[model samples]
Target chain A: MSTSLYPLASLPQIEKTPSREDGIPDGLEEELRAYGCKLIHEAGILLKQNQVAVATAQILFQRFWFVTSMKQFGIGDIGMGALYLASKLEECPIRIRDLINIYDLLLQRKAHIRAQAMASRLASTSAHPRTEFKYTPMSYFGNTFYELKDALVVAEMQILKRLGFNLTVVLPYNTLVNYLRVLGLTSREDVCTKAWGYLNDALQTPVYALYSVPTIVCAAILLTTRHLGIGLPSAPENCWWELFDAEWEDLWNVCGYIMRLYRERTSEDHTRVMGMVAKKGVRQWLEEHRPAGGEGH
Target chain B: MSDSAGPSTPSRKRSRWDIEDEEAQLEQAQQPVKRRSKTKSAKTSPAPEQTRSSAAVEPQRTTAVYKRPPHSIFVPPRTLHPPLMPSRSVYCYERLNSIEEGSYGVVFRARDKETGDIVALKKLKLDEEKNGFPITALREINSLMVCKHENVVGIREVVVGDTLTQVFIVMDFIEHDLKTLLTTMPAPFLQSEIKTLMMQLLSAVAHCHERWILHRDLKTSNLLMNNRGTIKVADFGLARRYGDPVGVGGLTQLVVTLWYRAPEILLGGSTYSTAIDMWSVGCIFAELLLKEPLFQAKGEIELLSMIFKLLGPPTTHSWPDYHTLPLAKSITLPPPQPPQLRQKFQYITAAGIDLMSRLLTYDPEMRISAVDALKHPYFSESPLPKHPDLFSSFPSAAAGEKRRKPYESPPAPVRAADYNLLTDFDP
Candidate 1:
């Protein structure tokens, strides 16, 4: 009877590596990580622009890449599929055609960027990108498009399988709004708007992945109130944090994760992150014995 | 230790806790990376055991954590969101027999092995659907989550089979739907009994509408009743949260079973409110009174004519916006006829007729709101609605649970095939 149930706890997601021999190169893997972040952000923008609820779409994007790596699928198609799935789950269905059309347009634009780069880099390359006026469903699957529309359909299914069809994703936005109302912050428009902004930024991080909705909401409130220099009751089960049963440490972790996301995206730590981290013992094992190691480039 | 977890034995059977302890001991050996890779290769292929493995292995605890072996394209980071702690699946529930299916899933009456409680297990249709999990199933969960009124059927929990694709939404097992009661009851419902059922239906609808949600599909089949005469609104596959009719969030024109659909919907009107549901309630009220459908037409045109025949056709005076309606120019309906409430259903009272008229009005704007309909003079006129405790239809709860024949929908004589070479398919 409890509405707040996460069914996926019983169905743990196993990491799928196609083959150790064909493992992604370090540069490409790092690029895909950055690409995953960029693609989900773009997906967030697309959902907002198209009037689809942004929370579900953002959550779906974050959950999708966790199931499968970018090496096995196109991030664009998967992100679009994630958005489409979110729209449906949220009970605000955008036409599937509308989503497919948007994806096709993005593909066309990416093609244009590639064409310019190719023209600048190679004078005599024969495989010139197709310069279609507009992308139709037919043209999208044709030529260099390489049947991406079909891939989107297929990848969506694969993503769901990886998720184990655990579609019940709870958002902190609703809980935050209710908590704000309960905390009597409705009249405080400035504070409410600031908290709303923090929540949006928090959506882009693993704050949701690591913490529960209550923790994320409490984290947003804490960050917002601290920025405004507002005095708080500073006690558990009081006016602000009392409504939630979340740990103060988890709330701080939620804030910390968002801060890390910001730092990772803007700083030069983007490319060097993989080599810099303590990958520990596992990669060393693969490099020494696996024949496919150095030839990955 | 990884050697003993052979291809034949399912890791699902092998508890993750056991593996964790063993894996910890293996890693503590401090052997070269080769020893670890050997373990990695062992895990990479977890055998093809399809049945009864609780493969709830958390890769986060393993070296798979952010460990990208440059050799494999498929190896994912272990830091990826930890999946929900895998729970025991639907395999635990012993399915007794198939109950009737509604919406996109087939439901079964099952017993929870752990609790021994009888519950309705709904298995959603997965194959042939390119879309992953059905949206209707999600909406049902969403609606049931928010609308916790006693009159609304609650979803107990969702369980997945051995595979994630095979999901089952478990709900409290109600023995009888309204359709079953309507057919099985020997005599027609008493006036007070009818009022009781109507009040419960309206209460549930009002609860949904108050939350800005519409139960798009509201027919006798979708309404479930326990022996206690409590009506729970069941299917929400077509239901949605609606704002103002002209609001920026557009609504799909397609919804509701045709028999219970409102006139505005059938006449090609796009936007709808709770009025459509009220109209269905009116149809249901009439059916409760007569023990059959008020308007059982084969098609849209025929259904509208049935409405026109009884209530009289819509005039410019009745619906000022009739001219702008999409069906106004396309379909030439028959001219208006005088209302015939008294002769058609002679049993209903004058107050009942007035309430019926208000509910079945051609203009949706004039339709009786659920809140207002409950306070109508019909209930106050003679026999007040009997208390729910007194309106029990079954002799006992056990009697209600006793399986009768499988429910069969009333045959449509008009649409029934009367195939004959000369008579039906004449050349």
Candidate 2:
């Protein structure tokens, strides 16, 4: 069973797959062009920086695809649907109207792809004015309580099988919250918020399934404290140390990618940076040394 | 109360029995008044069928035809008793007896007093703490209600319990399931006996597939047989109802028992269709003929490898979407293994081998369905078992009698770990 599961080193990098409207296959380049793959990559980086938000967003994305695909509903609705489902599946459930508003924000004419025109045409036919996409009561989507029940049970069984059924999966949020209270780390409020959010996002990635929830929470706390330049704990527990060492490199990579995206925006004039991203494509502009913006990677 | 009729007159006798004799007398009385009635109105009149229905002797007379359904088709009650509380609204002749524990649910021998017939009452325990009745059960009942066949378990009533605690179902009971029968057989069923069982299994499944129902769980244990050796497929706990292909439906990962699970399911593909069920049918066929389970994988990954070892690795040619599955390209699978037909199952006949190959096709579109498999050569030649009509009926067996065996259980698989996924595979 373990052999079938992909290890982190073995996982294939997420690449854009060729897709078409019906059954026809389109070229990868054309598909990428149509989807604004460049912009999505930037968003992924920005999300990775704020790990919690990224995890939440990804959860939304996967759940949306899962639910819609299961119901035999259209895949075209997945982008918005993912967020809608994710918001609930994640701790923060967003309102449908607000999510549609976010869809309008995220999908405004960008480096590539213009879904606004298509969206407006679809929206006109929608019975609800508030919602950008027409809504159907796929009670099965809400009926996820059953599926989740199964998945959670499976998850426990999986954890037991992998660890020889010994380790207990202590819930992360409670322990993290408790630790935060004890440490009195609430002084740097913005840092705390960002760290908490990043930690939440880690769950959306497959990495969550790799280790116990407590290990993740501990790593999140350590990363947050380190970024703040606070004195580390004198005597770190062996379990905490083990998680920190194993994940530090991966976490650093994620944090660096996120930090670069944010610093690029904050360093330059807000309007100017936005314009540069609009023109060069966020991915091209953020590259270490590509004559500011270029066609090729 | 037509007591004024004269004795010895044909009119009197006819008038006493039917309305025909009185029709003429009534017409004679109304003829004189017809001229006035005609002047009054002629705008609206009832249709012939409606008139005949109205003039029928009694509404109860027509209901008798419906009381006993024809041999070919049977309609179980649609609005069953509510789960749990054992509602008397749905008729049950007998009280709850000791439970007959199966792999999935608790079964009991029950009786129906109205017809003096006994039934097997299966109490399905749904985890209400987690959710409501499992979707598998929902799909099974939804499809089974519409399915009318003698080879399938006749769902007498779906009694919805008041709350989570008390839900139960009352169904027609047979004395023995196939697993019990297999124990009594001297050895593995002869090729002919195997053919008869497969035919019955296929007939039931074909009926289900025609109605867009997928029996996700299909194994020997789920198959029940009467003393006369007629097999009826039971246990719809893992069944699913799909109206169209690629519809947004639930991911049924834990569909079949690990030994009988298909490779596609093991790949973590959330939504493989009826082809998954056919794979289990193939497994059952091989098991019956070989007298042993096939491709026993202790865990999910190992289970997958075992399947690959037997059937060979699925290529784009075999399963077109093999590469595109979400989890397909993730793992770096070893070089593809060739199909090892002879090494694993050396004893099965060549005809059996052909049938197994057809039914176990990796490509769902290419896989032979139950109905098509029935037309296979395995059932074409040699001695076919007696059909339903010729088979002797046992009053006690069909009426749900208790033929207790000294508690024999299925051999538990020796595995490295128990990775029980909560999807509806009971074993």
Each candidate: how many clashes?
A: 20, 27
TM-score of 1: 0.64
Q: Could you give candidate 2's per-residue lDDT for residues B1-427 as a string of tens digits?
A: 1232212223322333243434445434433332332222221223322322232233233333422211111211111111111133234446546546765577777678788776787766665433223434444554566565778888776553444344456677776666555655545676666788888889888888776677777888788877666888888877755645443434657678788777777777876777777888998888786676766568987877677767787887888988867778765666777777767667666777788999878877798878789888868766664455454333343344545565978667644235454333565
Scoring only the A-chain of each prediction against the true A-chain gives TM-scores of 0.67, 0.38
Residue A18 miss distance in model 1 (angstroms):
19
**Cα misplacement distance, residue A144 of candidate 2 (Å):** 24
| Residue B86 lDDT (model 2) | 13
lDDT of 2 at B401: 55
Q: Please state the error at residue B181 of candidate 2 in Å.
A: 3.1
- Please, what are the lDDT tens digits per residue for candidate 1 over residues B22-109? 5434433322322332343334333312111212222223323322112111211112223543234787799888877655889888
